[model samples]
Target: MSSMKYKSSEEFHDHLLGAIEKKRGYHLKRFEEHKSEQDKGAVDALAWAYTLIKFGKGNIKK
Candidate 1:
């Protein structure tokens, strides 16, 4: 993985997108271990992306 310090925030956020996919697969695999979906879903990557944009990670305005 590329280090965030060396990459632009745009690059870092792009890389984070891929990581999010992998994380979803991992979390899905552990479904049985979770007592409730809510416990595993305080927020997903897509939601965070909106946050990143809205609060100022990407290009969207608040």
Candidate 2:
């Protein structure tokens, strides 16, 4: 990891994309925990469904 500070929103966004792409398990678990904690029932369910339908067919690379 680089010791670089995000100077702009775009930089932060890109950094987040790279982090999520690299740390799949961490991000997924965090999302699940956050959704449960917040009690975002229907919205979270729909998002999960869309994620499965959108990315379910792709090959996972580690």
Candidate 3:
């Protein structure tokens, strides 16, 4: 069997959530910086991060 990086499922879930949150924060900052320029790509990335976090928060279980 393959080895698991996380000690347990809850740990993995928390890690995943943290990663998504970090991405969201990064994209939010980028979006703010580019908002004056009307950057579509930055907006899309921020939206994607928001959607992923929303879904992940609702669907993932410990």
Candidate 4:
């Protein structure tokens, strides 16, 4: 028996997409806040988040 809330693969993908979008928003805010400080890690995180979002969106379409 699975304890997961999503019962279908599409639902699971949607959940993942929502999670990634939330995290991407966080990373974007962090990058903005630390931009003036030249935070390398923040920039990298933001870039990775964007990449993940793009990949997720692409996968969800198929």
Off by over 4 Å in 4: 1-5, 36-62
TM-score of each: 0.42, 0.33, 0.53, 0.53
**Which tens-of-lDDT digit does each residue in 1-62 have in candidate 2?**
87767677556555654554445555456667785543444445545654654454333322
Q: Rate the local accuracy (lDDT) of all candidates.
A: 0.57, 0.53, 0.65, 0.64
Q: Tell me how candidate 4 scores on lDDT.
A: 0.64
Q: Which candidate do you rate higher for lDDT, 1 or 3?
A: 3
lDDT of 1 by residue, 10-39 (tens): 766666666766666566556547745753
Instruction: Give per-residue CA lDDT, model 3, range 1-62, as digits (tens).
Output: 99668777667767766776676667667668766444446556656865776566646554
Measured by C-alpha RMSD in angstroms, how accurate is candidate 2? Answer: 10.4
Specify the highest-lDDT model's number. Answer: 3
lDDT of 1: 0.57
Q: In model 3, which regions exceed 4 Å deviation?
A: 1-4, 36-62
Number of the candidate with higher TM-score, 2 or 3: 3
Model 4: lowest-lDDT 10 consecutive positions: 53-62
- Tell me model 2's lDDT, rounded to 2 decimals: 0.53
In model 1, which regions exceed 4 Å deviation?
1-3, 32-62
How would you encode candidate 4's per-residue C-alpha lDDT over 1-62 as one tens digit per residue? 87677666677767766776676567667668776444546556656865776566646432
